[model samples]
Target chain A: MSVRVVVRTFSELCITVGAVIVLFVVYVLFWTGVKADTAMDDQIAQLEEQWAKGSASAGPGDPGSARGPGAAAPKAVAYEDGRPFAVMYIPRLGFTWNKPVLEGTRTKTLKKGLGHYASTARLGEPGNFAVAGHRRTYGDPFKDFPRLRPGDPVVLTDGTSWFTYRIDTRPYRTLPDDTAVVDPVPEKSGYTREGRYLTLTTCDPEWGHSHRLIVWAHLDETQPVEAGKPKALRR
Target chain B: MYGFIWRHLPGNTWIKALISLVLVLATVYVLFQYVFPWAEPLLPFNDVTVDNQ
Candidate 1:
């Protein structure tokens, strides 16, 4: 081949090789990210189990316990499917994922557990107990979150404590700011009610977050820890 | 003509393919098993406090 032709061919080959390497890197990054997420789920589950037991045994009055005044209650244990960790369930969405919510609804927690809004409502209260999670990433734990119809059950079990709530009105329109969903009252009206409410938040689209989707539920009942099966086995 | 020390570099497609496959497998195994576990502690958010610790 002529030198010019040879150089052109070499340049094309270099570009092709570079493209392949780029594609491989992207694939590996995505795969590793997913693997990391799966590992996180397992870790959260394990942490939930440990936290549940530790909280249960320590009791509210215990010196070294993490339970707050509201955290001391014992109910039927609940665990997620992939790991031996406790999860709060929303029977309406059939939402089952890991628990002991994290701060700011970080991507990692949303990956493992429902990210409870740190500033707002308590676990079992008469106000909104808002939780934010990813709609697609981290196994899409909240993939069905927005589909939760009114009257569907939302359950949260801390291995010894199980709290059930039913889907209520999901009146508010979609928004981007997550904090707005858990505002003291409806963002548009600023209206607050006395009844216990559960708010499930996820990305609007099935696999992405062009908008925010929410499912609202009302408290049905709180069951005792001794009334249900051991959460460890369930996990 | 001088004798070249590193003689023929065999071009074996099968060997190249096998090596690529082995690399991919090793990557998967390490990512899923050892590397993932090792990287768990590096997760900053994993360690948190909900209440008075």
Candidate 2:
């Protein structure tokens, strides 16, 4: 090819590549957020429908919550992989800020909503209930993660009960391999005993994952759904 | 690579440019709806878990 033609072709290729990169950015920032918001809404609707079905089939004396205080604790529902079982609300994020919590931390599972660490304890249990969410993309569920502070409450509901957990520490940054942050008693969480705790993790630096930001919380109180919103959730 | 496609168009320059623009828009749509979702799992930047295993 002539030198001028070759130069034109090279410049054209560069321009096309640049356009593609810009399109990719748009896909990540705008399109993915739009899609994730819809997915989260669908998940919440599905969970609500399931819960309604569950309650409709049971008698008045059922739901375990109607039982006396000295009775056995409510049985935890088995969380299915990739399925949403709970909705978490963080007032610190915003009054309208809520996200469905799905089982498993797989990449696909997280795209839809926050994912629970399958190895961690189930919600409201006497162990660390760990969860993960994206920091910058896929709706940026934890985009304001750094705003979390000690004493802030994270409320979650699993159809039958509302569990409120109060933050125990500010955001803790560590490498992704520091799996101990989700342990029954997280090493850095400053807890010396087992308890009903919540661990929230998201990627650090907003745009990168070289590190993680963690917020640890302990169960403050739990009440049956029929009791209205929990004290922490009250306006 | 793009030069071949531009040369093979069966129309004059203006028509070829219009067809190229349509093709580019179609490619972008395909990339967003299918290619990106498929390729996203293969990338690690979205990972937020401590135990990747």
Candidate 3:
């Protein structure tokens, strides 16, 4: 090819590459958020529909009876991986702020909603119920994670009851490998013994994951769904 | 690169332009639906948990 034609082809190739990169950015920043929001909505709808139908296998059984004196703790639901079984609302994050809590922390599961660390205690149990969420993408579910403060309430519903957890520590920054942050009695979490706890983790620095931000909370109360909304969630 | 395709698209000017638009959109759709999602795990931005070792 002539020198001019060669240069034209090279320039066109550069323009195409630049366009692809920009479009990839658009896909990551906007398109993924769109798809994730829809996925989260569908997850919530799935849980809601299941709740509305009152399926026989609903595992959190008879919250009212479970809480009575001499009654056993409610049975933990056997959640399938990547499936959402609860909806969480962080009042400190916002009154309208809510997200589905899926069963595992896999990328595909996190894309739909917050991922519950499978090893941790299930909701309202006697150990830490840890969850992870993206801070900048996949709808930025925990983008305001740093805004959490001591005494903030993180309420969750399993359609059978409301489990309200009270934050006991501010957002604590730690290395990503500090898996102890999700341990049954997490280090630096100020608990002397095993107890019902909640740990919310997200990427540190808002848009990067070089580190993690953790907020530890203790289960403060449990109210049956037949009762009205929890005090923290009362409008 | 576009010039080569524009010259060969069998149609009047407007029709060729429309066809080019359709082709570009189809390319984008493919990238979003399959290519970008397939490539997403290789990028580091999506990791939000300590479990990803």
Highest DockQ, which number?
A: 3
Candidate of highest TM-score: 3
Off by over 4 Å in 2: A59-75, B1-7, B11-18, B39-44
TM-score of each: 0.60, 0.91, 0.93
Query: Which candidate model has the greater lDDT, 1 or 3?
Result: 3
Query: How far out, in Å, is residue A56 in model 1?
Result: 7.5
| i-RMSD of all predictions | 11.0, 2.0, 1.5
True contacts kept of each: 0.00, 0.50, 0.53
> What's the true lDDT of residue A144 in model 2?
98
Model 3 misplaced regions, further than 4 Å: A55-75
User: Which stretches in model 1 have alpha-carbon errors above 4 Å?
Assistant: A1-37, A40-48, A55-86, A92-103, A170-173, A187-192, A229-235, B1-53
Across A31-78, the per-residue lDDT of candidate 1 in tens digits comes to 545754666566666766687677678675434443322353444343
Residue-wise C-alpha lDDT for candidate 2, range A135-154, written one tens digit per residue: 98789999999999999999
DockQ of candidate 2 is 0.55
Shift of residue A26 alpha carbon in model 2, Å: 1.0
Cα RMSDs of all predictions? 8.9, 2.5, 2.4
When sorted by DockQ, best at the front, the candidate numbers are 3, 2, 1
DockQ of each: 0.08, 0.55, 0.66
- Write candidate 1's Cα lDDT for B1-53 as tens digits: 00111123234766656666776687666655665445543433232212101
